[model samples]
Target chain A: MDVKEDLYHALLMEYASGCLDEGQSLIIAAHMALSPAARKTVAQYESVGGAILDDCCGKVAMTKDALARVLDKIDCGDSPSPCVQKSKSTMAYMNAPNCLQTYVESATWTDGKGGYQTISVRTSCHRSKARIYKIDPDTVFRVNTRSPHQLTLVLEGSFHDGRAVYRRGDLIVTNGDAVLHSDAEQGCICAVAQPSVFSVKRFVQQIFIRY
Target chain B: MYITATAVKSLAPRAPHSVNKPMESGRAQPKTANTNVNGAHHKSLLLRVASKKDREAFAELFEYFAPRIKSFLMKGGSAPDLADELAQETMIAVWQKAESFNPAKANASTWIFTIARNKRIDHLRRVRPEIDPADPLLVEDDAISAPERMGQQQETEAMAEAIKGLPAEQADLLYKSFFEDKTHADIAKETKLPLGTVKSRIRIALEKLRADQKVKELWT
Candidate 1:
């Protein structure tokens, strides 16, 4: 591999291992957005890591209680009932630590429709935070955070955005604001770590609180 | 790519009758097939089984994965009983979240690894004073080196063999990079080499690892 490719791979290795600093991570993410070859190489490395992990646990057997618990949960049928309709206008909030005045408030909320839901954890002032979001089976959620750093970790289901398939547990961290299209088969569940919040009003207040 | 002379002797001898059966003969080629989608597929299947409350699948998956998780922990310097307990805890997470399995975003091992990795990290953070001190480098040496430990399964054993073939210096670098998570500069300082040379050697080692068919044998 050439110097650029090598650097890209090195960045990718660090990213995969969660060792990259914020600025370095952003650079790699931007490059990945523009370069298919780099993305593929990253995928290959991830594949290698995944494969090794599999071998380490070869034919992993779930514990005896593992299945029993699932069965029990299924028997309970724990999903929120249709009768308890979620209000469309209600927005929930989870405040951050008092010390984190400069950071955006982080919250996790589930909607009645389960279609439009988000788990956001960000600094109100600084542009660095982690958020996870999910859209129901047929709906889509749009984000327009014009920040210099963004990181996403998929928690469940899948979505297609640009060049890659965002599946369950896939970490897709990027920088800047971009259009996201996710009205696919499985919907989308993602954890987003970014420098900014989705709303400007919140951003202004965040700054005020910080100062 | 240099295999120690002794390592060549450790290969399991082939059966004479294996020559007649292509399937059996091919099986001797090393166990890389299951590492890709197969690993993920099995995980998805287990998740489905959990969602559907298929007791058999759940039991089988738990039986298989729990022990491996334990083994992984044990190798990482965790006491055997504690490793087993953590493995059980990981399985509990799997059971509780079985209904949420989504194969699109992550392969199975990645998902499981994320959970296990998170749990392990959390456990270490909770228990280790060094983590709170914020000096990761000082504590890195204490972390269990994944490559050094022999796994419970055949495929992992094969991978161990492949890793053994790498040059000692290259292997050490890879170990630090993967397990200790040391950067190129840190590795350079440790090895008394220039940063550029360390980077070059690491690049070359990874390339060689990626290209070797024999290296592929253990990943399944």
Candidate 2:
């Protein structure tokens, strides 16, 4: 009950509708890892999505030899994805969902000229960009961008986005540069998803971003 | 925290639904295949595929889910051929992850469709790196929880009915938001409604489903 109740609820609904960008979705993933209530609520939304999916009309069967092709593709029946393995190993501290963790591992993070580094993960299906960022303790960072909609989730430590304190499992969604200033209480990592048409810049005024 | 009375009231001046009313479905929705109300048979079929490496069982699953997946992807705006290809990949994922499916947590229909959703996203990332519009609707293997007998299933039925009961414009918004993969901002641009109104309408629709007394009753 003490959770970031309304915000996560809205985010969960966005997630249920499949409208969240990857950055926002990843935040939900980590937040769910921290909150069982969020997990249960999210599960319910998934069920809602499932219920609707069951009602889609115009069912079509697969192409010829589809079964044969799949059987051939399977590594003798069961194929364990590497992402699942990583999820298990990293569950303790990372607390990131397997899907996001898989992407984060492969993504190339760029060290900004401040106490922060970032990796733009995936460009969205609708021309947005999903980025992950790392910030150091006691550091203040600024993102000057024209993203109409953006989402931020803290994977480590804590920070305040001028308006509220966001911790390891909180998702902060904003409209138009809502998080112009972020002061980290400790080392922090965040994933941000936004429209790709606009460029983003982060600055710490004067601080070295340790690799 | 529960929906605040103020937020719920501001959402829609008129609370459109009286939750506990027995469902009066005007739409004669198609029953799922072979009268399998819960898709329990599909789960058993999946179990066989997992434990026995049953090819026949997988083939049956392929027939049932592949096309539906195709429909799902296509509805979300994938090209027909691409949708077909992703559908194939989704079924393959199901084949590979059959052992991971837990009927106690989800029915097969829910499980397969969830996988289908993820596969579609994976395909999008692989083919087009520049496209980054995130689709948040994801169901993962680790997410376990059956729909409350009084909650999800009843909510689904009520939602379908609710969609029917919605004002035509609001109903259209729901379809685009849920089925077409359209964002609220995008919907506002298309419908010429303000973004705030679009967000409010979609959020209100969801609140309607979540506010169902049957859901609260079940939980309580």
Candidate 3:
């Protein structure tokens, strides 16, 4: 497999194994929403999970009343609330994939150094900080990596890095000491997940760059 | 997609005595037909729960999957009591979400497996973002024709067979990844194998499954 396909396959394997954190999962979900191929691959991986589960021979008996309790709940009309309903509003919400819409709705954007906007997303993994960046049209954004690992997924519009252009649903993975410089031809929105410590150094760099 | 009369007869909610027989018979027997037949039976039961609120059918499904789900959770290191509670929650979700189970897309085991997986995630207090299949922006698989779409059931059966055909070590790795929720690095650490070896083994297993005639015909 080529590098991109290999990376996505690895990510999907982690996803199917339930090893991915929330932010990384959101990236995969969003990509699947846009690409049928990713969804098909994820489905195949999940079928493998199902087959393994089905093949498990060990049977741990439940507590004596387990069935009775569950049946009682069903009779009592107890069910968790259905998946979050899609709300109506906002250009960004409209453009963002359904999986990312909830986060986009609650995100509070603040001004960044280079006329861009960013919001820190709440993710379950303590090791990583997830953020969404909105870049203005015709803007150039340069970021130096401090994180050992990072993932950036384009959600809307397109950005041209020195090597290639990333459009919606495309993912860019940067590892240790890489520099990311992109120019947005149109207003661009992207989600990023990286080590939490990277944010502090980036903040410091922003201050120095501003001065 | 062809449901023989015997399959339906085996699945229909029978008398209490007969319904209890399968529970007493122990685990499902390993056979190529067992997974597909059991899947069809469970699908019918789930659909009954959906259409008629059939408690008997639900009971049969509960008897079959709850113990397995409990075992699945325990393998992931959850305490027995916690696993029991989550298993109960998963069954309840199964009842509530029965209306959403589309036989065209997934069989009973695959559907319930997802519900259990999500329950485990929620128990860990982690969010798992899922793509809504109904989302307007979601791209549909137009490459598949109508006749090919009808092959999903056979594909699932073929998948189970392919998994069974895998080498013991490769199958063990898959069990670790799915049942134990271990990452490649975790498996590597535990097995004392290189991470690349673990990953490649998994990839090889998946590629083998994908190579099944039904699976390849349907998806690729």
Candidate 4:
């Protein structure tokens, strides 16, 4: 049994805190799926969230018709659709989580430059977006959504994030005003979720993995 | 108005003695016991919704949680209108998924607040685009049946007391992390502390929290 307790626990803490990078988040989330100890620890942090949420003690009134509207939505079957069941079952996304699938299936692929391609995932809630990307091995996938927060989750293959290697199921969340350039060690398929509108920039293919 | 006389009687021990009167339906007043959530009144209301498809019970739950949820979302910077939309969606989910509620696992507040948190996150990510990856408000199901959540039901008072006992520095860091939703990097930048120091401070606070004798027993 290979257990990276401290490493994964820290990751879980970041995840539970919602500060984890997309790549590392996917990794930790995947790791938690298989690691009970990590799951238990993350649960502790989540409970901490529960504690604070309880203490917030303020109330903002909802409109009188709010409940009626929700009931109306339910009556009309207008709630969020999970996805087309059959397409999801046959579609192979490897170890990707179900939440990832809902947005991934939203759009068709655009074009790729230098083995990197992207498709923006449409969401009904007008505030955010989900994008799916395909990156070939030995490439630096640079993104500049300029949005305050962006999450990258590796659906397949691996990448080197200038800190640690992010393999399949890894998530990396980056914030700030700087553009990011991360190198992939192998063919990587990822989904990027954000609220800002962005299209895939040009990809630079290079071999940098020290094997 | 949805709480029946029977429910008010049944939940007397769990709620403040004041709300037991039919005239004091709790519609205008939110319960003061923030810590002792999952009150029996709420559990009974949800149970009614689940078993009887009781709209009145659902209405009562909506009145209590919807506004609180809207405020919760706004604290994260959601617009009032958007927050209202998300809160509405959250209530609908509660109505649709009320059957899944298990009072033995979690209180009504923990469960309903979680739904609000998720809706807020989903809503923010759509509109704002650049949310912190480690946004501290990302909630998990807080039910007792959720493995580690089991013995925790009986420990909120103990946990609340223990939190007051934590070092001020540690508590401040926790406030920033949990209440303000600051990431370690963000906290470090704001406090001028090294990144490692910020993480360690948070880690220490968490360790102290989890190490509480009563809390430990609950988790175990």
Cα lDDT tens digits, model 2, B121-210, are 666553211111132322233443445532433443444444445454454556565556766667767655666666666566656656
TM-score of 2: 0.65
- Candidate 4 retains true contacts at a fraction of 0.22
- lDDT per residue for candidate 1 within A1-211, as digits (tens), equals 6653455456576555434444334334433433344454554454444433454222223344644654465456533112221122212432211111112233336442325555443322332344335566655444444653345544456666676776543445443344455546666655455434355344322321100
Cα deviation at B116, candidate 4, in Å, is 1.7
Best candidate (score: DockQ): 3
Off by over 4 Å in 4: A1-10, A17-21, A63-211, B1-40, B102-107, B126-152, B155-161, B179-181
**Preferred candidate (lDDT higher): 1 or 4:** 4
TM-score for all models, in order of appearance: 0.43, 0.65, 0.81, 0.57
- Give a tens-digit lDDT track for model 4, residues A1-211: 1122223344466666555544335435544443345556666676665554443324677787888888788788776533233233223343445434433443455555556666554445443445567776666545544655555666667776565777654556555332333454557777765434343232112211212
Task: Residues B1-220, candidate 3: write the lDDT tens digits.
Answer: 3233344235332221121123333445456677667777888999999998899999999998998888888878899999999999999999998999877777777788889988888787767788877778886776656665576555556776676676656666677777777766677787666665666767776777778776677666
Q: Give the TM-score of candidate 1.
A: 0.43
Candidates ranked, most accurate by lDDT first: 3, 2, 4, 1
Name the runs in model 1 displaced over 4 angstroms: A2-4, A21-39, A56-211, B1-44, B50-53, B71-86, B96-106, B120-175, B180-198, B209-220
Best by lDDT: 3
Write candidate 1's Cα lDDT for B44-91 as tens digits.
566676567666766666655665566545544567667766676676
Chain B structural similarity (TM-score) per candidate: 0.51, 0.63, 0.81, 0.61
How does model 3 fare in lDDT? 0.70
